[model samples]
Structures are given as C-alpha cells and as structure tokens.
Target: MKLLHTSLAALALAGFAGAALAQDPTEIRIQWYSDGIEGEVMQDLLDRFEEENPDIDVVLDNVAYQVIQEQLPIQLASGRGPDIARVTNLKEQAQHWLDLRPYLSDEQVAYWEENFGNRFDWMREDGSDAIPGFLTQLTMVGGFANATLFEQAGVEMPGDGATWDEWVEAAAQVMESQGTAAAFAIDRSGHRISGPNASFGANYIAEDGSPAPIDDGTMEFVTKLVNWTNEGLQLPDVWVSAAGTTYRSGADDFINAQIPLLYSGSWQVANLSTTIGDAFDWVAIGSPCGPAGCSGLAGGAALVAIEYTEHPEEVARVMDWLASEKIVREFSERTLFLPAHAGIVEEGGLEFQSDDPNVPPALDRFVQASGETLPLADQLPAWRWANAYYGALVTRISQAMAGEITLDQARELMDQDIADVVANANQ
Candidate 1:
C-alpha cells in the first residue's frame, strides 16, 4: 500500500510540471527605435503587455532610428526577424510582412476605417491586397511662427484662412519692415522639404506606380522659392544645415527676435517649448495650401510583426493594445505629438499656452490648416527617394537664392537629381 501511494504522488508531481511547461510561451522578440523619453515610454508599455500575458516572454531589441530601415530587410531575409517591429513605411516592407487581413476581425477593420480615414491603402502594400501592419500615429507638418516678432513689428496677424500667397506676402512685409528679423525660414534639408514638396504637388515618381521623375509643378515650386527669397525675405544658411544638428540655433534666433517664421513638423513643439520656455510667444499653423488645397506630409512610426514568429496572434494582440485609444493618448501626450488616433485627440484635450499675445491666433491658423491638409503617400520607395531628391533640390535652390546659380540652372539641376533618384529607386 505504501509503495502504491508513493507512485501516485510522483505521477501527480510530474503532471503538474508538464502543465506549467505547457503554459509557458515559445519566446517572442520585438524591435523598436529608441530615443530618451519615447524609449522609456515604450519600455513601460512593453512591461504592461508582459504582465497581462504571463505566458508570453518578450525580448526587446532597440536599434538606432536610421539603422532600422536598412537593417530590417536583411534581418527579415535571414529568418531572424523579431516577432514584432516598429515600421515607418509599409510599402517598403509589404512583401515581407504577413498579411494581417486574415487575422483581424471584420468588426475591427470597420472600426479602423471609420475613425482613421482610409485603412485599405495604408494597410496594404502595392495597392492590391495584403495588409502589412497597422498605423499607430499621424505625423503632420505645419508652420511655426514667432508671434512675438510679429507683435513687435506691429504687423496685422495672419488670418486662419490665409492662402499660401497671402502668407508669403505677409512674411515678406515683415522682413522688409523689421530689419533685424527674417520673414520666413525653413530647413532646406530633405527632412524639412518633405512637407513643402508635398504641398507643392511634386510627385517624384509617377502615379501609375512607375518611376517617372519629370514634373512641371516641381519647376514652378523652385521658381516660387527663388522669388520669395528675392523679395527681401531672408533665407538663413541654418535652414540648409546638415541633419541631426539641433534646430536650437534657429529656434534661438526666433526667440531672440531674429527669425519670425519657421516651417517644421509637430514633433518640434516640445523642443521649441523647452528651448524658448515662454520667453516669447510662438504658435504653429498648418502648411499653406497649393493648387490642391492644403496637403501636408504625414509621417510617424508604426508597429509590425515578423513573418517567422510562432506567436503571430499574440504579437497582433500586443499591437492592437498599443494602437488602442488609451495608448495613443499616452504616447502623444508624453511625446507632444498630434495623436494618430482620431477620437483620442479630442479625449486628451491637448492645449498649448504661449507667452506672446499673438500665439492664440497662430494656433487657430494651425488647427484650421490641419483640418484641411491631406496625408502624403506611404509608399516606401517613393517616399525615401523623394526625400533624397528634395534635399538636393533645396541645396540648388539655396545656391540660386545666394546668386551662385540662376533660377533656370537650379531647375535643370533639380530635374536631373529627381530623374536620378527615380531611376535608382526603380533599380
């Protein structure tokens, strides 16, 4: 009887151990770009995900922002891609991503479509079929103007519904009247031009999904830029400076009453606030409209799951949670980004306070502009190549502005640069 009892006890212990092993998840890996505060926020969110799903163990691999775009493809090809990754452009990674259409419920897809504009093109690559990943944020570009400078000049504030031409006239007037301050300033680098290039209706590649760089609108844009510069408007050298250099010098110029208007994205709001700290009032307005009403470039990071992952369902769950309204608000609030999710912005009730009295009107201008602008295409090759082309174009424009080249010469150079980029992207 004692031997039988011992045998039963040993068998029960073995069964319990097997059950525990079964409950443990086959490990999952996630990749993300990390910066100081955003990284910390992501880490906190990941911890929460792990806590809720005890069975799954998550391994996070943080890579530099620039490296991820080039490295992700190689890693995916090697069969060593993380179970999840934060992707920016879906068109680039569409071939590698598992089509999420099969995984998401019909109801979920409907909900996404209603709130987030159109999810069909955003989720699919090649514009046919295959949902690559979900969009978690809405990136926007607007005009950041130093309201204090305008007040000092005693210029009538720009109206919320002002057109691009009206804005240019106002800026030129300010520069002429105010000797020490520039009327308008922008980073001529690829990063800054993305928004304006889109506004100008320059498509680096053709709409038929082919590599075609020639566009008349592009030349018109160059002409407009040159004309603006010649109209007593200051085009600061700092606008064309290299990437990764802090915009602090330029922002400082604005705060110190040197530059009145700076064109940049919503992400700069926090940096501007911290750097200027209410010394003077500053406000952001939406990018002015072109022939096609206001069209601003939309860019932000997104989360994607790896094709090789054993737990695609589990990874999708985490992604869904991250894209939830609560998470969007948390991320946007912490990073000072315009919320990607539609309702969350209203729910979060984000408000900006400026020391300058003119800031309120400027904010209204931005809000109106944002409401009318359209998002840029998320196609990877086109987006990336356009950025390169725009950078070169800006440099050429800057040279023309400084009398180093004629407007015609700048246009020809830009045309050649665009042609080269489109060819390389096709190859």
Candidate 2:
C-alpha cells in the first residue's frame, strides 16, 4: 500500500509538469543582417506574428555582415547556430538548411511548389527539390551617377546603349571640369567587378560547373580596369591601396559627392536615400554594355531555416508567415528591398516607397537593368561554388591591383585557387 501511494504521487507530479510544458512558448532565434532599415521593418512584422501566434516567440540576432560571411559556416558546421539565418552565399551553404516541405501542410506545400519551386535550385543540393528558404532581396550590381556633379561639370550623362568606353570618356570630362580626384569610383569588391566582367562576356563558370574566372572576355575588363586605375580615371586608393581580399567601399566617396560615377547596386537605394537626403540627384543607371551583351549580376541574401533547429515547426511557422504575399509585399516596400516572388514582381513591380523622390526613379533604373541582364549573369550567382570562385578572384585581383603581382600572375593564381577549391569540394 505504501509503494502504490508513492507511484500515484509521482504520476500526479508528472501530469502537472506536462501541463506546464504545454503552456510554454517555443522560442525561435534568427541570425539576421540589415543593409538598411530592413531590420526595423522585419521587427515590426515579427511583433505582429508573435501577437497572432501566442505559442511562439521570435528573437532576431542582428550581427555584422562579416560575422555572417566568415563565422556562420563554422557555427552551422558545429550544429550550434541560430534556428534561422539570413545569408548571401545561398547555394554555397544550401547543405546546412532545413527543408520546410515536410513541416508544411499538403496544401501549403503545393502552394510553395507552385510559387517558389524554381528558386529551390539555389536552396538545394545538386538537383534535390528542397524548399530551404526564400530570398529577402533580389539585389544587383550597377552604377549610380551623381547627376549634380555631371550637371555642374557640364558633362552629358551617358545614355542607354552607351558602352563603358563612352562612359569613361564622359567621366574623364566630368573629372577634368569638376577637378575631382577620381572620375570613376568602384567599390573595392570582386562582386562589384564581376558585373563588368560578365558584361565583357566572361563566363564565370564552365559548362561542367567548374570555376573559370579568367578568360578572353575577362581580360578585356581587367586590362581596362588596370589602365583606368593607372590613368587616374578609377580611384586607386580603394582598389590599389589594399590587397588580399580586403573590402574598401567607394560609397563614402559617392555620399560625399566627390565621385561622379559610383559603381554600386540597388541595395544602396534605401540606405543612400536616408543618408544622402537632398545632397544630390543620385541615379542608378544601366550597366554600360560590352561586345557580348549588356550583362549585370543579380543576387541577394535569403532567410533560411537551419538544419539543426530545435524548434522546426515554429521556425516553419515564422517563415511561412514572413513569406506570405501580403507580408512580403509590405516588407519589400517598407525596406525598399527587391522582392523575389514571381507573382508579386509581375504585379507591376514593387510599390517602392521612400522619403527622397529620386530613390524611386533610381530603383526603376536598377529594376529595368536587372530585367535586361544576360542569362549567364543570372545563372552565376546560384552556382554552388560561386563564393569560392569569387573569393579566389578577389584575392588574386586585389593582389594584381595592388601591384604585388602582375595581371598575368594574378590570372594564373585565380585559376589555380578556384580549381583547388572545386577539387576539394568534389572530394
């Protein structure tokens, strides 16, 4: 009779514990980064999500972009990273993502397949159909013209179908007239250079999916780049003053109105609008064309569910809520981020909002240019080995630009470095 009473008392305690556990909300942590005010916009939406779903709590960890780029793979590899992460190298890290298909209801799964199925290539392994995540911004690399500088210098802005040669000439005239230190300022990033490389007809990836950064087409871009730097047309301080994959932004020069032509991207729209209010008429222009075609790079970061999340269901819940058309539409506009949704993009473009009136037209130029990018440019960003390929390019090209190595030597090293990475990945 004493043992039976003890067993009954234990059972009673267990029942109470289970009831208390049921009332506890699941907490899902997000590893987030923001190029602009997107973090604030997302926080507002996340608060709304929590209000509706009382059993879930969302925590956003806004870390440095460098942390996401360098340290995230280490954390994710140890299976100790955040439940969700917003990342730029989507295909490079697709293996660590949690496929949300099984967690979704059959109807919801069907809807996802219908809407975002195609993009899963960037979120999957090889040909696997994994709905790992969706892009938060459809970003591209191009140039922004400080029109006030052009007008002040009495230099005509290069129009559509103008080649880089034409733009270079116009920029020279502007610099001579305005007495600016640099005629053209490019962000010290290989990603920024890759657009112009593609425009010159360089196929960044081989047919068999190998890295091939240097080709006849890319040589054209590299030659011009070196010439422009030496001739003082392109700022040497940003690219030549640094070496070994260092990032030096020319955004400051553009923001300071010291640069007439700044090679940046659509991602700068919101941040520049907020920071450069009424400073000048900044306009995003189409990428200057080349012999092959007018090419531009389209890429962005995605919010992905990590494979090691303890709260998979709750993570899916948050992602589903965030990926909804209405919410996505709102996020895009409020943050000035380009949406990746097909239907929404086709609904006459995003209703982009901004305090600065020039932002909308600048955004339109970027959007239109993105639409005109060559097929190869669109495909390269989703390549599984893009980060490796780009990293090698950055290192080698920066070395060349810094005069630590000749262009020929840099090209040779780039090819070798990328090949080694591909071989290791294959192994």
Best by TM-score: 2
Clashing pairs for model 2 are none
Give candidate 2 regions above 4 Å deviation: 1-22
- In the range 328-355, model 2's lDDT, one tens digit per residue, is 8999899888788877887866677776
Q: Please state every model's RMSD to the true fold in angstroms.
A: 4.8, 3.8
lDDT of 1 at 325: 69
The whole-model lDDT of each prediction reads 0.63, 0.84
Off by over 4 Å in 1: 2-15, 18-27, 34-36, 59-63, 73-80, 105-117, 163-181, 189-216, 227-235, 239-258, 289-292, 308-310, 342-367, 374-405, 425-427
Evaluate model 1: give its TM-score. Answer: 0.76
Model 1 shows how many backbone clashes? 3
Per-residue lDDT of 342-391 in model 1, one digit per residue for the tens? 67655546543334444445434544555665444334223435455655
